[model samples]
Target: MSKKKLLVYGSIILSMLFWSFSFVWVKIVYLIYNPITTVLLRLIISSILLFIIGKGIKKLQPIKKKDRMQLLLLAFFEPFLYFMGESFGLQLVSSTLGAVIVSTIPLFSPIAAYIFYREKIGIMGLVGILISILGVSVIIFNKNLNLIASPTGIALMFLAVAAAVGYSVVLKNMAAKYNPITLISYQNLLGIALFLPWFFLFDFHDFIYAKPNIKVWIALLELAIFASSLAFILFTYGINHIGITKTNIFINAIPVFTAIFAYFVLDEILTFQKMAGIFIVICGLFLSQAKLNFFRK
Candidate 1:
């Protein structure tokens, strides 16, 4: 692979890693903060940090008047609706389970991508997605093949998956026009605006009364800086370089990363089945990215 290809893959993988860590971080934040409060504060902090860094580096692009509505819609699908589902869902599910559910974004994103951009996945890509989803199923299901997670949590996480699919469709239209930093900075800013009323109405009092210690505060910061800010920026870069279908397929790796993190941080058990599933997930990721010409050769 060339340097550019390497960079795109690196950025996407790093974004997945950051997002996987987010599941763990949000769990820590939930020990004291409510979902609304956590997401609101996360957006606020990320927006501020992104703007400061973007401006200091002179990389922030001005939003064109024509694109304002599109950007707002993008933010609505993502940091607004997406966080609402993910934050609440994580409250009721294990971090690994939550990540696994969110990782299903690839399964749904292709339809949206094709409808919006005429982006089509080849045979290899389709097979890879199926294999990876099967791997995800292996990780989530018990030996009896029954899912034991909360139904509400599963539904909420699927809500996040839908929001993410919408976000990618909108993002595909915008990524070519904006740099990652500018896009994510504006995204978080708009997300904050969208979430503000809900925050005040539901979680304001809780936010005031919540006394988070150093550890919780640190986790919140990590969520804001790495997951909210940097992950979105990197993901935007991936979408700009590769189409949405390919970019989203990387999401399957989140479960693997989350499982490892959950084991260490949250003391979640990592069974042999989960490890085998992780290996399968990695194989599927590689298969999705492999060039068909190589297979023919």
Candidate 2:
């Protein structure tokens, strides 16, 4: 492979690693801060960091007036709704489980494309979707086929998945015009605007009164720098260099990273059922992206 290709892949992998660690970091932050406060503070820090980066690079393109509405909506789906779902969901479930659920974002993106843009899904993609659903069931259900985790948490994580798909759908329209950094910076800024009110109404008092320890502050800084700012930049660069589908394929690795980190860092159990489910989910993700003529060479 060419050097540029290698760089793109490396960036994507690093992005996933940062994101995987975010699951653990969120768990850490929740020990001291409520979900709303945690997300609000992270976005605040991230937005400022992104602004500095954008200014330093001299590539921060201004959005046209007509496109501002679409940009606002994009922010709503992502750093706003997506964070709301994932951060709160992590509060109730294991980080590993939350990562597993979030990994399914790519599985359904083709369907979202089909629905929103009239794109067609291959037969293999449909089959992969079914298999992935089965994998999800295996993860969620126990030996007795009863749900093993919090239903509300699973639902919230799915909400994050849906918001992610929506973000991609909208992003495809605007990416050609704006650079990745510009998009992320503006979206994060708008998301801060959207979430700050909720944070004040619900979480501001706790944030003001509670004395977070050093570790909590450290986790917050990592979330702002690595997960929210740098990771988004790398992931968006992947989407810009590659297409969204290919970039999304790399997202499947997040659960693996999260599982390992959660095991060591959070002492979360790596159960047989979870491992089996993760393997099946990854297989389905690969199959979903499989081409029709693979052996032609």
Best by TM-score: 2
Measured with C-alpha atoms, the lDDT of residue 137 in candidate 1 is: 75
For candidate 2, what is the lDDT?
0.89
CA error at residue 270 for candidate 2, angstroms: 0.6
Residue by residue across 1-297, what tens digits does model 1's lDDT show? 999999999999999999999999999999999998999899999999998999899999989999999999999999999998998898888898788778768766765766666665556656777887787677767889888677788789989989999998889889989999998999999999898999899999888888999999999999999999989989999989887768877887788889989999999998888788777766766666554432221
The residue pairs that clash in candidate 2, if any, are: none
- Superposed by TM-score, candidate 1 places the C-alpha of residue 296 at a distance from the truth, in angstroms, of 20
lDDT per residue as tens, model 2, 183-215: 989998999899988988999888888889999
lDDT of candidates 1 onward, in order:
0.85, 0.89
Misplaced by over 4 Å in model 2 are 292-297
Best by lDDT: 2
